[model samples]
Target: MTIAPSRSPAPSGATWQRADWASSFRNVGTELADVAVTASRGTIPAELCGSLYRNGPGRLERGGQWVHHPFDGDGMITALRFEGGEARLSNRFVRTEGWQAEESAGRFVYRGVFGTQKPGGALANAFDLRLKNIANTHVVRLGDQLLALWEAAEPHALDPHSLETRGLSRLDGVLKPGEAFSAHPRFDPGHRGAPRMVTFGVKSGPRSTIRLMEFATADDPAAGVQAGQLLAERHDTMAGFAFLHDFAITPNWAVFLQNAMAFNPLPYVLGQKGAAQCLASKPGEIGRFFLVPRPGSAAAERHAKPLEVPAPEGFVFHHLNAFEDEATGELVLDSIFYADFPSIGPGDDFRSVDFEAIPEGQLKRCRIDLERAATDPAGAVSSDWLEQRCCEFATVHPARQGREARFAWMAVTEQERGNAPLQAIEKLDLSSGERRVWCAGARSFVSEPVMVPRAGTGSEAASGPEDDGWLLCVVWNGARCASDLVILNAHDLSEQAVLELPLAIPHGLHGSWVAA
Candidate 1:
């Protein structure tokens, strides 16, 4: 597939702004997809987290490239901020022990070609002993401390402003043995109870199990962590499920998603033997979901009954945003899923991996309509997953603070053998289960569009009146030249605006928006 040009015709009745960092990479004619955005402080690096805070649609202003340093790891840039003409970013990269590239075995050779599983031929013959630098699960800022939970690595204390690791919790027996952990961080501002910390862990062994933990940030800092009292734990083993992708939390309930690790699919695709041989499994694997009570309360149970989710094997997730609907106390979850593995194989060159088959990617919406999970909590996925052979890489956008209005944006590709070519952005109505492709072409693959709320549309229009509910998206034109950012109306997905950057961005991952 050809990477589109970095320019587009401006859309009607829509306004767009291109940041400064979108012009650095030379788009090498491959569609730049999987673009995610977030707001943060400090220089956002070129990797996933750094790119989130990248300046869109402009030339890299001298030191802009310096924002994304060499050390940063893969994590979501969920938040970002740009002020005084400088961009700052913030997010957590899980740090796990013995899980780096050096630890991974030699690259997996399929059909005489090699796919990068790790750097070395084998750990015994490898040069770097450190393996790969594992990242953090999910982290959030609470006053001065940035609380993050990891299955294998130590829980780090980072300065929210500088994004530096200042201290770490001496995690000893609390960490369960596994390939990785699942618990993601969330900020629960106290409304009825004290603040709580929620996390999940995957314990690996003959039988893999998923564990959930909850604790408090304001508890006595001098007091040593109490395994039974300081946290709540839950375990489950259906299909030997352990790995969890992303999760969502409401005031009273927490939602869990399994196997949502998008860009980090190396371990899963490499098989358990490959994973164990190389220490690729950090904590969580085989994505599964659970629901537990928020930490720091009288009702806290030592091991809360984890309401399981309906995530199946071989389906990986990206993120899950949970919200409570007024009409029903039940929680609604919006998520993105990669239904099946693309039959990808490495070419003679490392620059590209070819897909053996075209993926019919899909976006799914599931609602937990009961107080407790009925049937198998591990089976909470929507019915669509049972039918579609393949699904798209998708992002969920909630509109007007209502679940009914939530939208799912996906880039569904045309199926090929090893890798299917991603084609267009299909907008799905969560409530109706209907989908529409606002923009589609074999030459292009659209990233998650930035759903910008127009300002002063009486705050209810909330997205702003400038375009009356619109989406500002970076559409990568597959042209040999630069790429483009196109804005569309969120309500219609039909009206569009194109903003052309002066240069092309090399194929990258997620990015976010910053209101200047």
Candidate 2:
């Protein structure tokens, strides 16, 4: 796609002044209410069907007070549904206790995990450990239910058709009240044709405890799932402190990159800081990997302990994909790795964060030699940095979720080396050493791109590569002070269409595309 330069005047900020990126932090209070999406560039592809559901912080302030961190903002869900040759867009906020109470009283009522403090000083916040589930991290559809997810707590169910909050979901009694469910659920297109959702929750301490689960969604006549039903469960105990946000899964294995870190709750107990602020990385230790077997796998029958592997001393927040090579007894895992946990002290302002000083995530390919796993799991782990271009929010063709594939796409920075806002979408050809970038330049920041398989049409239908699809994502256009849903050809990284919106959406983290 052709790169575009900024047309609007730059906005000012206190610290590093990147005008385009600075606008991504602005508030998007009004909902779209099912508005028709108009394309300004090219025609919408006929093969592209179904809605692109995305979630992130929308409202950043309560009354006149600003939130200390963008992650603390209220969850806003956006759906851009594509049909025949047109698009329909709608957005809504997931109503939660904190959102309702703060809106009703016209002020901040809850302390957020990141740094949004209460009205008074630390004195008023002291010893009050109550947490309000923000439900702002991700959105997914399984079985017959639509859910807005947050990593630390249960998901809030929403009406998929109307974007209305229904209530909290318990996975058909699989999860009890106050149970923790990971927001980052990995969809396993298993070999048996039984697609399952895999996720886990952690309780970190001296000896951390992990609860892993696999659940199947009930299929309805409409071809949509009704709700997720429990299929399997396992409890594991690991040594040392554990902080897990995401994991990767093959047909019979689930792998997690656990950062070596320590948690101190004293400052949080004294109301001086949020619980997240207390986490400190163990500088001298190597990062670890926890590999657990699937319920029906041979390892499970033996009641085997989780295979532990030591990795390069660093941190990993997200993984692109993974697959098992049963013939070779190797597991190929590709993920984004950082040198350390990127953080700031309680006194620092998140809005003025120095991007250059923070560690940028680079793609890394890790190979686990399962043959040597039992005797020396740590020594068996080997990794190599794929590319130096800073990137994150990586994805691949839906059908290639847990298999060896040619390409992986993700949001990348405009520059080649340093850390900056993600302003482009990169297509990394793993088989070949070629790369393609579709950049909107310094004026537009993007979200995670969701790939949809091209429907069978004419000649391309019978047997096209899995990577044959269109890439869809939302872009915050700083030039227009608005947002656009951009579409690109996955094969060539060419712009197909740009559906412009009247308002801007705060840059979001993750999203999914459901086939029609």
Candidate 3:
């Protein structure tokens, strides 16, 4: 397939300005109650009844001191409830232990993993290996409970309706104290029984170990905690430190990409830099792909070990989708790759970052002949670029996950090339390489788009057309210094409604949609 640049033009009079974009990073200190919001353009679909929950860094500064990186800020959640052709918005902080302590003392009391240090310099930070769980990556709902997730620590359970913190949860003893639970969880539309949620946890050291877990969805009320029933768990250990943030899955396999990077903890141990800053990418090294057979699968009984294939030379953070090609006997994986590790150096200002200096993420497709990989691992993998444009946070319909999906929607840069803020949402047809885009004007920025399929289209009974849905995203309107909830037709990138929000939300990481 030959992909081309989008021909759809930006909104009239749209122009990019750095100052306008930078205004979105300000700290928001107030928690908002349910505020009635109406669409300023177009009309809300009457059938659209669900809740949109988003998680991101909400506070960038404290006690006159600023966080070195936005990732270090405390977590804040924004919830939007759509019902009867109207919407209500609410925002609240996660209120983690660290956030509570900092609020009580009115200063920075703990060091952050990304580079926010304590007030007393190196003497106060040295030898302090304790990490503060900011709970600021993603928000997900499992059965009747909602969780605020931070990949480095246990998740903090929140009241689904009020957005109130209910303290940290161990998933009914599935996770031990301080165990890592990944923020990225893939929902598997059931093939045999009921739909399940698949997620993993990693422990990195001289040798890294990955623990894959599957839980029953809300369909099973008798499950643990009325939702997250642990179905199957498996572990695989690999050589070298694994800096894994996200992964992909299919019906029979759990896939992971071990990027070509090394971690040096000297700086972090000595209070000179954050733990994430210690990672350095190897220039000419190739990555390795680990395909672990899912527990209770026929492949697990046949092969006692995972199949390792040589991946292309790049760093991957998120995957669009993965599937097993039954006819070709191959496993295909689609992901976003960066040329190298993206980082902000110590003592540098993150707000004034130069987009050109860092590598832009591009979508790529990798096909691995599983039969060949079992015998000849080195020659089993081949890959090519799917979309060369700068993009991230791509999603397909939930029902199409771990299957052949033809359509995908993601946040992309407004320009045809080069790295910049994601100012638009693009719909791509994988087979035909056709592209459609809806730019939010140059002064606006977008978050990850969540595709909510129209009710009754795709479910356990049958998988419908991929694009029969709506794309819900939060847009930062720089012109008005506020945010807007924009809903667009998934099939064609056209605005359906734009509900003006009362407050501005910072650029977020990830979000989810829960149907009412």
- The lDDT values for all models are 0.41, 0.81, 0.88
**Per-residue lDDT over 361-406 for candidate 2, one digit per residue giving the tens place of the 0 to 100 score:** 9999999997688788767988888767999999977666777767
Alpha-carbon runs more than 4 Å astray in model 3: 1-15, 219-226, 460-464
lDDT of 1 by residue, 384-442 (tens): 33113233435444233222345555554433222344434555555555655553333
Best by lDDT: 3
Which scores better on lDDT, 1 or 2? 2
Query: TM-score for all predictions?
Result: 0.54, 0.94, 0.96
User: Candidate 3 local accuracy as lDDT?
Assistant: 0.88
TM-score order of candidates, top first: 3, 2, 1
- Cα lDDT tens digits, model 3, 235-343, are 9999999988999888888899999889999999998888998899977898899999988887788778888899998899999999899999899999999988899
lDDT of 2: 0.81
Per TM-score, the best of the predicted structures is: 3
lDDT of 2 at 120: 91
Ten-residue region with minimum lDDT total, candidate 1? 59-68
Clashing pairs in 2: 143-225, 143-226, 144-225, 144-226, 144-227
